[model samples]
Target: MSEFAFEVALCALLERERDEIIARQLGASVHGRRIMDIVCVEPGPDFAKRVAITPHEIPDAAIESRAGVGQARYYRNCFDMHPDRARSVAERAIEIGFFERVRQGSRLYVRQTARYPDEWFGKLVGIENKPDLAVPGDLELQLRKDVSLGVFDEVILATESYVTGAHLNRIPDEVGVWRFRPETGGLEVVREPTALDPAASGVDIVDEYAGRTDMRVATAAEKARLRRRMAERAYGKGWRSFDLPPCVHGAAKTVSGADGIPYCEWKESVVNPAEECGPACPGYEPADPPEIDIEAVRDRRTPWVANPKGPRTQSGLDRFL
Candidate 1:
């Protein structure tokens, strides 16, 4: 099976089996360029509070700002970033219902609609999908980076290849192994992962040369901030981030009870629309894309809310102010 198909199938299976928030293709690095294939966010004490605030991501800058729910503060005073950037973040926060703004004597003031929940998310699990382990591409180095950074509470490798003694020796001991068959929707945990300490400082591998490597120490505070960002992003951006192709053959296929998996009739299997679909293919025919309400599907299959009443209950005048 194609790696894209395998990823979608696994995500669907995980979403059906697990109660946590599931997102795919998220930035998991604090300072480096590492994109995790799948991220599972376990709910913390105030997960519901977060879900109530907004269906979209709350800007990190707004969360870090000094805005309070009790009183409105001058917008400029709340953020430490550049004036233009701060304004942009505040505007996004307001748009997302995380912040409510009012104008006072030509000065804009903003306050949190509700308090930002510090305990909105619990442990984060990162998964790396490599369907064909025989052609592993920097798999070891990637896993090593994840283990050293300790950004995720647990790191897991999911593959369809048959594991041998040689493969286990190359993989990090702390990283768990899972053999998944996409066609059968079968998953077997070959090894269990050891929990990593996300609260502690970690090493960020910056660059590597022939014999030497450059690294930076990421403070616990930085990791904490990254974790919050990850949680917010995962909550907002689920795995079904793709659109069905605008081709006659494009169709939505259900996998493990989760709808909206992009399937191609010409190929007779799940396909990545972005890469595989276009007029360049001989089987392609112009047509309107299938009408699939992906967000509704997500809402039906998961705890995520597609649309919720904003936390702000102020009069209509206040909303425009």
Candidate 2:
């Protein structure tokens, strides 16, 4: 039953009957990040939570050849460099929130703002989770590298078995076939996927492996700017942002069950919050991890849709690309 509990029970049945925006694992982080066992997304406008991508710490083509470009260019022509590498890349982009320090009049900028979206995204899809399609591992070289990297506009495969016909002649007829059940959350579909364009098909910014050093060759405007930075990082990371596991008897341990899932209150059931929970789990020990709050952890694991660009913020990327 583990494929991480059938991928968190098909991400709790696609977050209770699909509304969209889901992320689990995510794309490659160079050469080691093929995560993707679920991706969904499809609401529209959230540009990674309204845009804010600031850090250009030097080299917007060398500040667009000395500040003569657009977006009202100035911020010392993109972070007036060499003050210790632009203050160490603006202090590591303001400690990872992605740059912020601003002033304007006396001049002191380091912005990375983002609220871009009149329609920043819609229809991304991707899913792969195979709860035993008769154990097909490289499943036809991973659905032919997801239909030759069409940055997912449909790539599905899901499964929990029971939909044979020789398993659709071993996958990849343009990949698409669900089945999932997770005891009654259901999913079916069985085949109906084929949309991918990625600006006239061109993606795989590197993943064929074999003495690779983060390979490259991406253009269709670099796969539409890395498909909008992987849909703005799957609309601000979801699919249960991993990292859980902590408990072998250190109390406060783990336990959420029902639809909130997550349970391993000392190996009693469901665990794998990304690879079998904690201390290098041999059913680890020492625990203390379930206090759960912040509005019941945003109504149990947020599923997107909270001001997704409602009261007119800005930048709908020129009306959805």
Identify the leading candidate in terms of lDDT: 1
Per-residue lDDT of candidate 1, residues 1-321 (tens digit): 888889999998999899878999999788787889999998877676777788898888899999999889999999997999989998999998999988899988999999998997889999999999999498988888899899999999999999888898998999999999988889999999999999999998766679998788889999999999999999999999887978999999886667988889998888899999998888999888889898898877877777766653222212112
Q: Where's the lowest-lDDT run of ten residues in candidate 1? A: 312-321
**What lDDT score is found at residue 64 in candidate 1?**
90
lDDT of 1 at 229: 94
Q: Write the per-residue lDDT of candidate 2 for residues 170-285, one digit (tens) a residue.
A: 77777888888776666789788877776664545345566653444445665555555665666555665654555643222222222445667567666665566656767576
Deviation (Å) of 12 in candidate 2:
18
lDDT of each: 0.88, 0.57
Off by over 4 Å in 1: 312-321
Error of 1 at 183 (Å): 0.6
In model 2, the Cα lDDT at residue 7 comes to 81
Tell me the alpha-carbon RMSD of every candidate. Answer: 4.7, 17.7
